[model samples]
Target chain A: MSLARVHNFAISLDGFGTGFGQSKELHFGHAGDRLHQWMFGTQSWQRTSGSRGVDNVFVRDTDVKIGAEIMGAGKWGHPGWEDDPDWKGAWGPNPPFHTPVFVLTRHQREPIEMEGGTTFHFLDTTPAEALETARKAADGKDVRIGGGATVIRAFLAAGLIDHMHLVVVPILLGRGVRLWGEDIEGIEKDYVIESTPSPSGVTHVTFTRKA
Target chain B: MSLARVHNFAISLDGFGTGFGQSKELHFGHAGDRLHQWMFGTQSWQRTSGSRGVDNVFVRDTDVKIGAEIMGAGKWGHPGWEDDPDWKGAWGPNPPFHTPVFVLTRHQREPIEMEGGTTFHFLDTTPAEALETARKAADGKDVRIGGGATVIRAFLAAGLIDHMHLVVVPILLGRGVRLWGEDIEGIEKDYVIESTPSPSGVTHVTFTRKA
Candidate 1:
């Protein structure tokens, strides 16, 4: 069975996955790259060499086999990429995700295959349906939930997420998209939660589904 | 100069200081002590003997000299506490606070002296003015900001808090009063935020005003 998983997701202290006023130039809006500094500091992101700190431990995903990914329209492009036919994705040719990436959006388009086995497939569907399609595309490996906040909240509220690893950044975004709320109250009952704080001042929290 | 400090405050993963549907019986409402389990497990609250681990390190507050406290009405009594004239406080005879406590409410009742040095003073004033009154009563000692979420946010938004120690529990209350949001956007620029994860899964986050 292919498990639905979310990895290396970062959010603000106030629960904002990204900051307000996002634009083409600002993928995370006012948030800038503040939320992902931990990942960037990791040896994995540094490639040749970097710190092997606790943050690197949670961020390292080279051992896992991810077959496919499901992301939302907000993450696929700038504000209005649908208007331009030439817009492929924010990720240039040879994107990082080398899998069949399912992009959830009302404006469905034909599949566009990028270099490095990454293909963008537009779909207008619910969380459950999207996960099903992504699972099939994932083959026998786990399906990664690539998010920008709204998409992750939807899947979490729907109880479709089997495992989740969220990094809580120290800053307070004040305004932006929230990752959790009253819609998913008591969500803790479904998962065994654990948190590990790194010396880097960020706390990495993981949620594993109950057996 | 006396500092305004917040200590041992517990909030949910989603930033809810307390739960929803609060009543006389449920101060934290749907949260039902879940957000405070970390504190209860500490040696301070446990009284006899408990884990002196990282959680206990943050929960211990006996060393500080607290002259006065300012808390919201919700922390003083239940939802309809105003209707009852005989209602003293939730903390029976000897309240844990051995100092004057200023309760923020519109009722504007007279001061009620309790057993110990604790005395409840009802004030219908702004956060700054209330802090002034509490400051005088504090007699040069630190003024602790006792909260139920709204009170804390008010002080925080007003830029009056000097130091805040918040414990982020692993659970998600889903529905309740939020501690941070758009109202306080960019507030992080004012203070230095640091987080440390405990062995018990709770993350202790502290914010210290810049020098």
Candidate 2:
């Protein structure tokens, strides 16, 4: 069985998943984008876009080492913009996520073709369908659940998630849309302290899921 | 002249103000709604809507305790349904913020009108303008910098805030957005802590701005 893990997901030191008010131009707002600076500075993010550069060792090794990528409807595709005649991918033609991707959405849309092997398919069914699709697509690789909290909670509640790696940045988006909320209940997690360092004053932590 | 405290805004445990997304229907998402549950259960939020059922001691002391309210354009208005126009305010006919509200936005929109003396003025001019407007409206009362993080940061960076209250919730968004980022540098804050316990397994902490 393929294991489900959310890797390189950054949380605030106060435990916020996303910042607030996601839009077409700026998804996840300013605070959300800040969480990505660590990864964005990495060669992984640049290499996927056909750029050449290298970040620090930390960014290269830990920030961008996901085996497979999974995301919810919000992160996968834009609603109204999907049909935009000029609607190219949100990222420049070459996006950071180069591997196979699974999108969790309620609507069915045609698979999108982009540079590299990236193919975006909309999953209109339940989490089970998304998981199955991701499992087959992952080819025995660890499936990384990319998210906006609701989707992550769905996987956690289903007990489908195996490990969680959360990078806690030191900022607090005092107010905005928020990452997780009252929706999560029954899921209990014992976080195994993987790493803790204050480089750039942000602490990165990883947890292993109990088998 | 009143002192501007930067860290006095209240934050939810999970780190959301009104919640995520653009759809007003989902505005303040459940966690956002739940964040205010305490205020709702109290006289502060309920009495504004003219519901006087008597609540706890905190409510008894702070009837309309909040001095002023601040927020972002994202939370002020949303795209209404096809038949209904988008010009509609976020809270429909009446919004909870009965006091003057400073809305952080780059777009130039006219001030909004609603019942209970709430007027949503778009602050494209500057953070100082918003603060000045809110202060004038506040009439020597404390100002509540309601936020989406960016707005809050603007106030914090400008040294325009006086106090902060953060309510740490237990859920994590995995990835949505963040609050503090690189732009914030060389600011000092001194606060007095006030802790309150709740049934939701969340702790509400109030920080008084100390000069």
Q: Per-residue alpha-carbon lDDT of model 1 for B137-169, expressed as tens digits?
A: 999999999997899999988999999999888
The DockQ of predicted model 1 stands at: 0.79
- Residue-level lDDT of model 1, residues A19-126, one tens digit each, is 888888999999999999888888888988888988887777633888999998999997898899999898889898999999999997999999999999999999
**Per-prediction TM-score, please?**
0.96, 0.48
Q: List ranges where model 2 is wrong by over 4 Å.
A: A30-32, A40-67, A83-88, A186-195, B1-211
lDDT of 1 at A117: 94
The top-ranked prediction according to TM-score is 1
Write model 2 residue lDDT over A56-170, tens digit each, in one string: 3445543244555778877655546556656545667776677777777655667777787677766777776788878888777667787866687777667677777666554
Clash count of each predicted structure = 2, 32
C-alpha lDDT values of all predictions: 0.88, 0.58
RMSD of model 1 against the true structure: 1.5
In model 2, how large is the Cα lDDT of residue A22?
66
Q: Give the TM-score of candidate 2.
A: 0.48
